[model samples]
Structure formats: C-alpha cells, structure tokens
Target: MMSFKRSRVIGAVSVAVVGVALSLLGSACKSDRAVFSAPEETFIAAEVDAGECAAQCSLDGRSVIRSCDGEVIETCAAHLACGGGACQAPCAAAAADRSSNGCEFFFQIPRYDPAKFDQSCAATFVVNTSLEPVEIALAYEGRKLDLSGALFRTNPGDATLIPHTGPIAPGESAILFLSDRDPEVAPPSPYDLYRGRIACPSGVVPALVGELPGGTRIASAMHLTTNVPVGLSMIYPFGGARSFLPSATLLLPVATWAKQNMIINGWEANATGPASQIYASEDDTEITILPKVDIQGSIGVKAARKNMPVTYRLDRGQLLQLVQREELSGSIVESTKPITTFGGHGCAFVPSSDLGPCDTLHQQIPSFDQWGSEYVGVGYRPRFGNEHEPMAYRIVAARDGTQLDYDPEIPPGAPTTLSRGEVAHFVRGTGDPIVIRTQDAEHPIYVGAYMSSCTEGFNKVSFEGAGDPEFVNVIPSGQYLNSYSFYSDPTYKDSSLVIVRAKTRGEFKDVWLECAGQNLTDFRPIGTRGEYEFTRVDLAKSGQAGQKFGDRVCRNGLQRLKSDGPFTATVWGWDYAASYAYPGGMALRKLVNTPLDPIR
Candidate 1:
C-alpha cells in the first residue's frame, strides 16, 4: 500500500477570513450588472531570423512566417525564411537482436556489492527495441524478505528520470531503475531478485531467484517463474478470519470448492481455516477446504446447512473459482417443477351497438339530472343499414313523454343546437322537450332525459326535458353573455351580465344564464341552451336615471334584475311592484305593496 502525504504551509497571521470575504466580493462583482467595452482593433507584422524561428517556435505557439490576403500564416514553421521547409531529427539505433521470432526476453541482473549499499543506491536495466510505443508494468511480493521499492525510467543522456507521461517511440530504449529503499536510506536485506520486460510484437518471460534461510544462494530458480501469455487469466488467493457455526456443513461442487485454500505467492495464508476439514484432489487442479469452528459452549446449538453449484474456466493451468451459496433455513422441504410451457388468453366486451349507437350518454351525462324529464334511462343496440354496414341510432324520448310543443329542429345525426331563449325556457320548466341529434354518424348518439320539479308562480311545474340539465348549465357565462348581448341587445350594459370562465370543453358545453325577474327572488337558468332573457322592465337603469321618472324606473329595474338575476319575476317585484309593469297574462299580476307613489 502506498500513502501520499502533503505539507501545509503556516502563515504568520490568519488570512482565511479576509480571503473568504474577498472571494465572495469577487464573485458578487463578476455577477453584477456591469458591461465591459473592448479596445479598438489593430494589426501589425514583423520578420525574424530563420534560426530564431526554429529555436523559439513550439507546436502550440503562434509562429508567423508569412502573410496572405491580410491574414497571418502562423503554422508549425521550422524556419522563418520565405523558402525554407520543415526538417526532421535523426532516429536512434535499433536493438541488436532482430531475428528472434518472439519479442520476449528476461532481465539481466548486475552483481551486488555490499560496499555500494546506500539508501539512494539503485540499479538500472536498459532494453533496446524497434517496436512501436507500448505499455509496461512491474509487480513483486516479498514476504520472506522485506524489499520494497519503486522503478523509474529516463531518456538517454538525461540525468533525471523522464516523467512517464507517454509511451516510448520506436528506435528508443527504456531504462528501469530499481531501488530497495528511497534515495535517503540504505537497504537492510539481500533477497531473491526477479525482473522481466515485454516489448510490442512479442512477449517476455521473467526469471526468478530465491535465497535460503541461511543465506545460501538458490541458483537461477527459473522453474519458479510464472510466464503469463498475453490476455491470460490469473486468480490470486486471499484469506481472512470470521466467526461460523461449529456444526455448519458447506455443500459445494468440486471445481468451486478448489479455490478455498492455497498459498498465495508463498507469502500470505490463503486458506480460511483452523484445519478440522479439508478438500484436495489427486492432481493439483482441484483443491478445497472447510475450516471447522471451535464453539465455546454447546448450549441450544442447531445444525445449519447450505449447498451451492458454481462453474468456472481454467486458463494455462490456473484455477479460477466462482462460488454461489444457497442456504436452507428450516426443516421444511418443498420441490417445484421447472417452468417449461406457457400459453396466453385475452377477452374484450363485445357491445351489441355500433360506435354511433352505444349509450355514450353515460360518458357525457354521468347523472340523471344532466338530462331533463323527456328521457328516462337510455339503451343502445347496433343495426345494419341497407349496405349491411353497422350503424347506430338513438332512441328518442317516448312520444307520450315529450310535450306537444317539444319539437327541436336539431340537425339529423349531428349535435343539437338551441337558442338562448329556448335554453332559458327549458331550464325555466316551460320549454319544449329535449331532443338528440347526430349527423356525423361516427360518434355515439344516446341522449338522456329526466323530469325536473320546479316552482312556477304559485304552482309546482313539472318540466319535460332531455339530456343532462347539468350539461346545459356548463357554458362559461363570460363568453355566453358576451355573445348574447352582442347579438340580442346591443344597448345592454356589460355589467348587467355576469361572465364565468370554464376550464374544460365539457364545462363549457353548458351555459348557466341567470337574470332576476319581477316574479323571482333569485336568478334562474333560462332554457336548455343556457340562455336568460331579461325584459326591459327587468333591467335597471343607472343612477342618472333619477333625473326622470322613466329613467328612475328603468334604473330601478336594471338594479333589481342585475342583483337578483336568478330569482323569479314574481319574487323580484314582491317588494317593489309599484315601480314595475305587468300585463294580464304576466306571472305577477298585481302588487299589494308599492314603493313608488302615484306620480304627482
């Protein structure tokens, strides 16, 4: 393991606070709303000597040698002269052995001298090559001996090591300097030496040597060296201490069990054990072991079991292990058959009606109140027309259910349209029965109708209507009023009409029109079309109407209508009948109490 340490510089005074403040101020200033103006543009040209250009110019710098069309030609120029061209440096010598089929070779060690032992002492090994740039790495593990060091390489004739920033180019050689200790301490031990090199276009094999306990030289221990082919797989063993159950039984396949124990690099203990159980094969290929745990006490002890089957591959006599553990917690045993065959089924509701005939009213009018009294619950069925093609038609309200005047001239097979007056009448329980139309022939054609109980004058009236009364009331008051006043009564004051905005088309589909009448105490919807009608008497004039009796009455009517638009006419004039007018057929025939005295 390598640890990196950094030195911190101490200051005579604490400047961090001021530094932070300055930093914040700088950021604020940069982000402030300020503008900067650039200086005027200027251009100039100059000449330099050819030798000066080659010496001072770098690949990244602007080396101007000529000018064309008012643009400077600053290329990687070797010379500044007008006709001078680029030049190349001489190449280095290649390796001596070029006939070898493989580019692999072993490292040559120099004789060691005890007199030369020093902390900074290092040995340099050079390898000459003609191959293109390649990568190289060195690794070693010294357990019996404590030799720890690093390696560095330098360019030829350079006193200092060349930072290994990039690869070495062709025809160039690399020097690997190895030191047992850092430049400041002397080595403390003499141990086995191992070194190797790998060049492009070929592979290299390393040589290994070890020393006995008594310091007896083990001459050229080449057999101990491991030569890994390019792209070869390697598995290093590792071991650690852990607590386990004493009676636990590990069931694993032969191959995976092999990785349980082995000496890793002849240094660290690679087997996880205290040695009660072990697994081994006749050949060195498979090896495994299950170390037993020594329990302090047998109180309430239970046996635990696990089984696992794993697979792995072996490359170049190296054992690669992969282990998967599957455990059984309780005594219960159950087996399941493997899933092999499968089938699927699906279903859909086959409605008997065509798209245009289905009871789409359910989607449009969710409640019975949405449709007036003319329609009951709606039913749909598909039918084939003359061409044998599917077509749907809506079942209109029963003949007895609709009123005599309940004939709506809606376009056949298309959505029905009603005038504001008609809509008001329907909502007021005095209009014609509801009708359904579908001219498009593609959309659903169902219409719903339900009876609405409303009080008309002194009697309770039953209105025969159709479809959703709620839908009839969903129109945005603003757009509805705007369109109504603009078309029906241009003189109508904008303020007299209260407008409402709708968020969706469904809400806008119905409009609620309300206007106070002399017979009503609250505003009420006009008809099924969301239209409200205010007679001239129902409207109130402005305050200036006080100048004249007619104006005063008109203003009073306007105020009453505007304030109580949703009430009945009779209720509206119940308190101020003297100021209003009524015909013999009017809902409010007469007023007992009058607010306005007989004109003088």
Candidate 2:
C-alpha cells in the first residue's frame, strides 16, 4: 500500500476540527444577540455649596463646581444648598414671601447619552424659605428615560440625590442624576407614544424669570436611527438603515381627515338594481364601496352580476360566460341524483347519476381479488359473439375447506355447482393455466382454465379431474382442453397464479425443471436453495409450467411449502413473460431477527 502524505492528513484533520468549532461558535453568538445588560454608572457627587445654591453641577475626579454660577464647592450639602454664599437671613425671608422685590433666577441642565458614557448628567437648584423647612419635590417629563443616577435639587449646590430621596427642606437644594437603570425598558410603540403624557410634581414647573413661562411645556422625545452593520443582512424595512422622526406633525389626524372626504366619497358609488358599482380615476388610485343591498341575498345576487361594470373596463363576453357557467353548474349539481350503497357497493339507481349501472360492481371487486375468482363481481361488456359462449368460472373456498361434489340430479337447464377444486380444474383446462396454493395444504393445485367451447363443462368437471367433461363450443377452453384430456393446455400462453398463505417463510427452495413439449424431466435447482429465500413462483417459462409435465399440480393460483431451514421462499420471473404472468412481481422477504444493516 502507498503511504499517505503527512501534510495532507494534517490538513484534513485541522479542517474537520475547525468546522466543528465554527459551528459551536455560531450557535453561541446567535444566543448572545438577544441578551442585554443594565448600563454601568461611574460618576458620584462630591460636594454641595453656598447661597442661591448652584442650579447645575459638573464634577471631575478632585472637585465639583456649580454649573449655573461657576462657583466651587467643598461639600455636597453646601454646593447643593447655595451656589451664592450662604443666603443672608433677610434675603431668604424676602424670597420666601413670594411677593418680595428680588430678582428671579432660572437654570438649565443637559441630558447625557447613556449608550456611550457611564457618567451621570445631573442638575441642582435652590429655593429659600424664612420659616420651617419646606418640602420641595422634583419632577420632569423625561422620567421614563433610563436616567438611573439622575437627581433633583430643592436649593442650589445640592449633592445628587437618588430617586425617592426625602423632599428637600427650606434653603436646601437637591441634585438629580441617573440612578436605577432598567435595561429591559423598550421604546413605546408609535400609537401608544402619541397618546402618552407626563406630569411634574406639584409647584415644580420649569422656572420663570421676569417674563412669564407662557407656552405649553416642551416634552423631549427621542427618535433613534439604527443602522445595520457592514457585511450584515437587514431583513425588515428592506433596507440597510432605518430612521424614525419624533416630530409634532406625525400627531395630526391626517388618516382620519383623508378617510372622511377623499376615501369615503369615492367608495359610495352608484347602485343600479341589486348590484352596486364603484369606479376609480387614474388620479385617485383607490375606491371604497358601501353598498346598501340586503345582506341575506346580496352575496348570491352580487355573485351573479359581480363582473358587470358601470364602467367600460369589464370584458362583457368573459363575464357573461362566467356568470352563466356558475349559475348552471351550481344548479345542476344541487339537483343531481345521489348514489346509494347496495350489496356493499355504491349503486346509482337513477339516470341523473353520472356513472353507469355497473359502477358499483366494478368498485367492489379489487384487481387482486378478481385474479383467482371467475364472475368476480367485476363488470365487463361481453363481445356480441361471445355472449353465448361458455366462460370458465373460478370460485374460492372458505378456509374451513370447500367440498366439490357432483350433483347429477339437477334439471338439464339448471346451472352446475362446481366446488373449489373443480374451479381449479376448469382453470387448468383452459389454455391459460393458473395455480393456487392454500396455506392449509403443503402443495399447490392447478385451477381450471377459461373454456371458449363449454362454460358449463368447467362446472361439470370433478375436483378430482375425473368426469365426462362436456365441451361447449366456446372460446379458448374447447380449443385446448378438448384436445388434451388432462386439461393442461398451453395454447393461449398466459398462465398466472394467486398464492394465498397464512404466513410465508423467509427462505424457500428454488425448484427447477426441464420441459419438452408435454413431457417434463430432470428437476434441478437454481440459485442457492438454502441460502436465499423464495416467496413466489413464476410459470412464464415452459420448464416451470405444470401443463408441460402432463400433471396439473400447481394450478390453483397458490402454492404451499414446508421448509426445515430458516430461509425465505419466493418465486419470481425475470423477463417480459414474468411481467405478463404476475403484473405485480415477487416480493423479497427477510427474517425480522436478521441484522438490519445487511438488509438496509
């Protein structure tokens, strides 16, 4: 043997390992796509400082400053309390009075992008009260946003406070920052978003200075654009990128307005008789319909005239034909006669039924069942000249066994009674010999053949193959059986068999024979008799025909066998003759206990 290349073997092994690893990696990556984690927070408040506490705060590692006043703060409380130095008692009292002549102050805060940064975006504000500590609450419209550490200030320079922190006291301010970040939060659908609203805590509107805060409060809504990554496929929206706009214009009732004037008028078209019609102009691509027809009979009447057009676009000829066909076919089918089951077959007693009289008979007799039995309940039109001709009739016996006794006492006009064995005799008598093997017996018997000359002759013949076989001038029977007394005629050339067995073996012996005219000799074996199982027999060859042997042994259309070894028995044909003899050829059977690998 030649040695394999070392490099080739190494390459093949590496490829297989890599393939397996890639498959596992792909599956793991698919699972990770749906997973989301809460955003992390890194910024924390350091200080709060003095009077008119800073309304907004920004912090670096070492220090924090009031965003509003640019004042530095040492502690979170002082920074939150007042961005201006600690408020004078007189000034605080004056601010608390609300009617005092002091300047009004306002501040602004920026929102941070959570998708990119871990730092909290926050703001602080201050309020002064001369009396006891006042409970000032903080609220904003963007409360649904994932601002986890965000806080609010009651007074300037207050350290950022987590949500639900106690209400702020007089002269004290609170800072707002991102706090509890919920990763599962999903953007609301457009329909729900349009109807959504947010309210601020009592007495907590955006600050007003000298001028009044007059317009409707502005609510900040975000519109996101998600782009498919390069080299990745985008499915829905059919494009690589999708964009959304959170404009106030989308909130208008455009759909409702359009429906009222444009769509509704076009739909309510003219009605002539039972059908209503609508037309659409090229400029208006659509038309809506609101027919006032009665609902009960409307479908039928509409269906009748559905294709008729008030406009000239409809094809009159096609529409008329379709309407006529539909009405005619529906009416005819509804009035047609029904079929009734009789003698286990569907029989149509009336002429209105599409099928002829013999439909039931043909349906009841399956092809396989008709193979062994004559007068098999199958319907066939007899040829004119063949009407009076005698036909061979084959009958099956009950499993308990049938008696084939000759009844000599019947009137000459009465039909004869042939038993199971006599039927076999008649089948063999005709040129077309058939073999029948019963499971109750060990050997197969030859059934009689079709007699063109004598239809009654088959019935007269005894099951034991003895009798004054009367010959009727009929078809094949008189030509073959009359010449050969043994009823083994091979003239017509088509010989078939029907095997009826309780059970078949896995292995059967293949018996071979040598045929010479009416003489048969030298029975030999073909194939491994004990090695392969045989289940069926093929009489297409002269050697296999029992009539060639002058003994009609296997003509009952069946064969029973007894075997000692664990082998299947089947007889099959090889060429066209086999095809003709058994339309459905032999079946190969294997023992259930045999290893499935070999059979498969």
Candidate 3:
C-alpha cells in the first residue's frame, strides 16, 4: 500500500504555518491554519537578491488584489522592488533556478514523497497563467526545490522546471512533466492520494498539470490559495477525485476543516448501490466510524444513525479504502485531531439501475463550523437517453426540533421539521434552483446534491441514461464568492456552467464571464426559487485545428468569472463523441476559484 512516511520538523517556519501576510490567515495558532509548518533551516524567500530588480515597492495591506498600472507603491521591504501590483525581487526574475539555503529539515507535515509510496514517478512542470511575474517555491521529499534560475515562458512550448523556478513573468507560465510509475506491490491497494502545499500570491491562480497513473487523461485543477480569512470557501476544491476528469484538484485549508464528522453511506439512498469512503486531512489522525443505527423517533425524524461504530487510524496523507454496501451505510467519523473528510461512492447509480448516467462519486464534507442554515440546492441536468432521475437534495440537520422550509415547496407528505440524526431529502420539480432555510441560525445542516443516472426511470417508465451518479457538499451562503478564476476538465470536450445567486432586484444582469479574453453573452436564467435564481450557459470547447468558429470562446485552463453579488457556480463535463453531445456525457464540480476582493 502507498502510505505517507511521518516526519515532524522543529524549525523557524512550518509549511503548515505559511508566514506570508500572516495576519490574513484568520487564526494566530499555527496548527489551526491550512498550511504545513516549515523546518528551522527555511528560506526567507522574501530576502531576494537586489541585482537589477524592479526599482521601488510597497506592502499594500494583504486585504485586496492590487492592479499594477506600472507604478511603484508607497513602501516595500528593502530587499524587494515593488511595481506593477506585486513586490518582486531583482534576483528572482533574473534567474529560473537557484538555491539560497538547504532547507533539510524533513518534518513538513502532509507531504508527497514518491519513495515512501514506493513509486518512481518523476513529477515535473511547465507553469503558465494569466497572472505573470510570480515567484514559485516548493517543498518536496524533505527539500526545498529552487527555481530561482530556471526559465519562464509566456506562450508555453517547453516550460519545464523542478524543485523550483524563478518568478513566472506576466504573459508567462511554466510546464511540468511527471513520469507515471507502477505501484511497487502487485496486490491491489487503495488509490494513492498526494498532499502538499504550493504558494504564490492570491492574485496568482496556479495549476498542477500532468497525467494520472495509467490513464491518458489530464489530471489538473486551478491551484488557488485557501488562506483568505473571509473567503475561505475559495480554497475548498474539495480536492480528491477530480471526478469530472478523474484527477486531484485542491482540498481543505486547515481553517475550515473539521477534526470530526459523519458519513451516511450510499445504502442510505439505494440498497443495491451508493457506496462511501473517508479521506483524512493529515496523517496519523485516528478516526472512529460508527455503523448506521435507525432513528428512534416516532413522529417526525432524527438526522443520524446510532449503530455499530468502528475505529481506525490512518497514516498522514492516506485515503481509506472505499467500501460499497447494500444495507444501511451511514457511519459517524470522529477524529482525535483536526482533519478533512470526503464521503461518496467509488461509482454508483442514483436511483440505481444498470442502464445509464453513471460516473465516480466524491466530495469533501465541511466541518460543523462551516455548515450553513440557508442554501439553494440546484441539481444537474438529466442523464443521457432522457433518463428521469430527478435532482435530489438531502438535508441533514444537526439539532433536534429544527424546522426546514423550502421554496417552490416540498411534496405534501415530506416533513419540514427534523430532529437530530434525521435526514430530509426532497426532489425538485423544476430544474431551476430550490432554496431551503432553517427557522433559526442555531441549527446548521449539511446539504448534498445527487444527480440521477442516464439509465434509471422513476414511474415504471425510463429514458436513455448517459452518465453516472455523483455527490458534493454544497457551499454555504456565507462562503459565497463574487469573483473567481477556474479551469474545466481539459480532457472532457463539452462543458456547461451552472450559476446560482440570490435573486435580489436586478443583480443577475451584472454577472460577467470571459474566455480567451472575449466577453460572453450567452447566460440565460433557467429557474428561480424564493430568494435565489439559477442560470445555465454552455462553454465553448476548443475545436479542431485552425478550423475556427466565429467568436467561439472555447479555450481551456485559466478562465475568469466575476459577478457584482455573491454567487455559486459549478462546471459540468461530458464526452465529445459527436454522437452523444453536451448533456450526453457526465461530470460535475463546484468550481473552486480565487477571489477578486479583499477579506470580508
């Protein structure tokens, strides 16, 4: 089995304690933040060479994204030259790879060491983004890789670097090429999950691009930093199982992560299918899983099961094997220290049937403090072949006597009040988004959205099912964002963006989307419920060589989205078999993005 080797560092800086702009990290306690701590022999990267650096600089508080209009700011560290919105080092931009100090302390937590996992994959990169002139630093396998003297390219052709590279200039990015290796053991093992920290400024949207295991598919996602004290939701790509493309994205920041939680397995929805798994944030955290117990209530319902609880401990940076079950599959997970959790099946059919709409399932569940009382769960489109798996939203209440109200309302028999350990699932009649709110803020709940398979039919009649079922913990209204930069599955040719925002007066009109530097105008309101409204828009996928579609904005990687009001957006992906177009295939994700605003 590929497992993380434990190493703890006693040092000046901890990878967990990323020290840049520290005040913005929300908490003063180092362990409570998202990053791993650095070793004592660390690189004070800020101390860059003064040789030919941009003259003049400033430290405009860490609260906002500064636009560089070719002017030096008010003040800058003596070693840095500030201009063009970022403080840069003359030495940093002068070279691509250079090592200032040997950061040999190996205690950085949540690490990615191929040797420990018994893999020989050589991970490399060519980085490029809309944000240029960005310096890059990486701590890998107990050493800090230096790119201080490496090369940076604007239009990528052969952007390559290792361990580190000089700051990527604007209009420039680098490329990474990692060789896929075989597992050391022949016996089957759980999937290998990688964890580490990559840092740049919040204005810089980074991405780790490469191939996954033996699959030819591209494993990539936007690498946005999750340290914003106010907009923490920006970091929760819920990383693992980038199912839409079958790779890893980003995961929980230590701030919004929980030390304990529960998972109601697939058995909760379908006896024949719907499985689940648990992913830990850090290694060595002990997790206890209690079996599903039936609610003991008589009238209304409770939220959880109180049955057999099993305890297991995991090494740092490991994912528990996914277990598929046919009976009640709910399990409560309690951990000794803070950690992150993902609950979903390896692959299952919503309204399970072998016929259609099937894909792998994965979602990072939020800790209790991150739960919200108000939410709008908007389901995805129907499966291929006209399959009628209705969009289902399951609400798990955390308190007893919690009253739930729905906009566009629930069916006559569905109960609105739920006790602790109870779950209330309701189907949406309109494809538009539906709103649910608790009577008071005292009770927060978990809202998960499930899409039906392309195969299953509801009323004894069925349509052609195309893809598979998947689930994701919806972001809370409190974590809603107004601006972001995101990337779609580069492997999937077809894509759609589902946009959700609170319907105040004329706010939707201000939503803007830009691809390949062209303004998009195809957004249309699909539906609305109570205080929220939904909009759907198709994305232009890159077409054939030199065969251009007039004004087609179909480019992948590093796209931008911004709105005047707080909003939620998800990007869906499917196949390109021209025979099975857009809605024909299946893949969905709540887009993780970097914010354009300062901390709230």
Candidate 2 per-residue lDDT, tens place, 65-178, comes to: 333334444333322221122222322312221111112211111111112111111122122221223333222222333223332332101112225345333222233221
Model 2: per-residue Cα lDDT at residue 257: 12
| Native-structure RMSD, model 1 | 43.9
CA deviation > 4 Å runs, candidate 2: 1-108, 111-121, 125-129, 139-167, 171-173, 176-182, 185-600
Root-mean-square deviation of every model: 43.9, 43.4, 15.7
Better of 1 and 3 by TM-score: 3
Local error of candidate 3 at 163, Å?
16
lDDT tens string, model 1, 436-541? 3222212111131111111111122211111100001121111111111000111112111222221222222222121221122232232254333222222222
lDDT of 1: 0.17
Q: What are the TM-scores, per candidate, against the unseen true structure? A: 0.16, 0.13, 0.55
Candidate 1: worst 10 consecutive residues by lDDT?
A: 237-246
Per-model clash counts, in order, read 60, 105, 82
- Report the alpha-carbon TM-score of model 2 versus the true structure: 0.13
lDDT of each: 0.17, 0.18, 0.37
Query: For this target, which candidate reaches the highest TM-score against the unseen true structure?
Result: 3
